[model samples]
Target: MSKTFKFFIPCDKAHIVCDKAQYREASLWEKAKLITHLAFCKICRKYTKNNTKLTDKIKESQIQCLDRKDKAAMKKDFEKALKDYSN
Candidate 1:
């Protein structure tokens, strides 16, 4: 692809670029192309909008998770319980 026309990517390629942009992994040129594609494609625009909303929701959710230490403790307890039951 020519350097000047690199920003005219297809819908599928645009979606991939959009995802990379969401993850902060896309290059500047890729982001430009995705934006351009979104401008002309309503479906891709909607897709991008929904994707952004989903990412925001995930970030804003008050979900908690176990740390590595907690996970290790639970694993040890489970293993000990299994061993005791087997005996």
Candidate 2:
């Protein structure tokens, strides 16, 4: 189609753009296209809403993670258990 009509995007592409937007990686043009798509696509709008909620929840949870030293210790223990089991 023509460049003027390029703003209209499909659901799959809109989903990708939505994800990119969530991660602050979408370009201005892509965000515009996604907005245009979301304007008419109810499914995509819901998807965007749910995705936003999930991101918000994750941020609010403030989850902690294991450091590299802790991970290495766990790996070593797991390997020892495996070796013992295989004997």
Candidate 3:
């Protein structure tokens, strides 16, 4: 929620990397954030692989995640977590 890190994380598409070289295999920070987000945000976890398209399961899960309400807020949290991971 800090203005400094606001742009780093979009409301969605955080799984989409802005720079592939920035994290490579991902640092511990990245991994930890990803893991934590995975626990809460199932859609991001299902679509963790950035190079590939979202899987059917992921799409379905994302739809389900959307259905649960808080769709926008969850996505924002997921993006912020991804930004924390990447940064």
Candidate 4:
């Protein structure tokens, strides 16, 4: 059963932050209080340890080219084929 955590603080309210440790351990009150703490403190929010948010910029790079040895072998094969064709 999901436990409902209730914390009403002035300046910021109704902030819902899921606490993985408490939620995994089935502690609803702790999760609710964490949500409450996060609502007021940005520093605590920044330092919160969890894996949900991946804020890092990810880039997809692809390299399409032959390696040095393969390139050399291809060049040699092309040269041999050209020589055979000319003869």
Where does the lowest 10-residue lDDT sum fall in candidate 1? Answer: 1-10
Q: Give the per-residue lDDT digits (tens) of candidate 2, residues 25-87.
A: 999999999999999999999999999999999999999999999999999999999999999
lDDT of each: 0.91, 0.96, 0.53, 0.54
Each candidate structure's TM-score, on Cα atoms with residue i matched to residue i, is 0.72, 0.93, 0.32, 0.32
Worst 10 residues of 2 by lDDT: 1-10
Candidate order by lDDT, highest to lowest? 2, 1, 4, 3
Model 3 worst lDDT run, 10 consecutive residues: 14-23
What residue pairs are clashing in model 1? none
Model 4 segments more than 4 A misplaced: 1-23, 49-87
Best by lDDT: 2
lDDT tens digits, residues 1-87, model 4? 334323543222222234344236525665667667777777556655332343221213344679999999999999999999999
Off by over 4 Å in 3: 1-24, 49-87
The candidate with the higher TM-score, 1 or 3, is: 1
Judged by TM-score, which candidate is best?
2
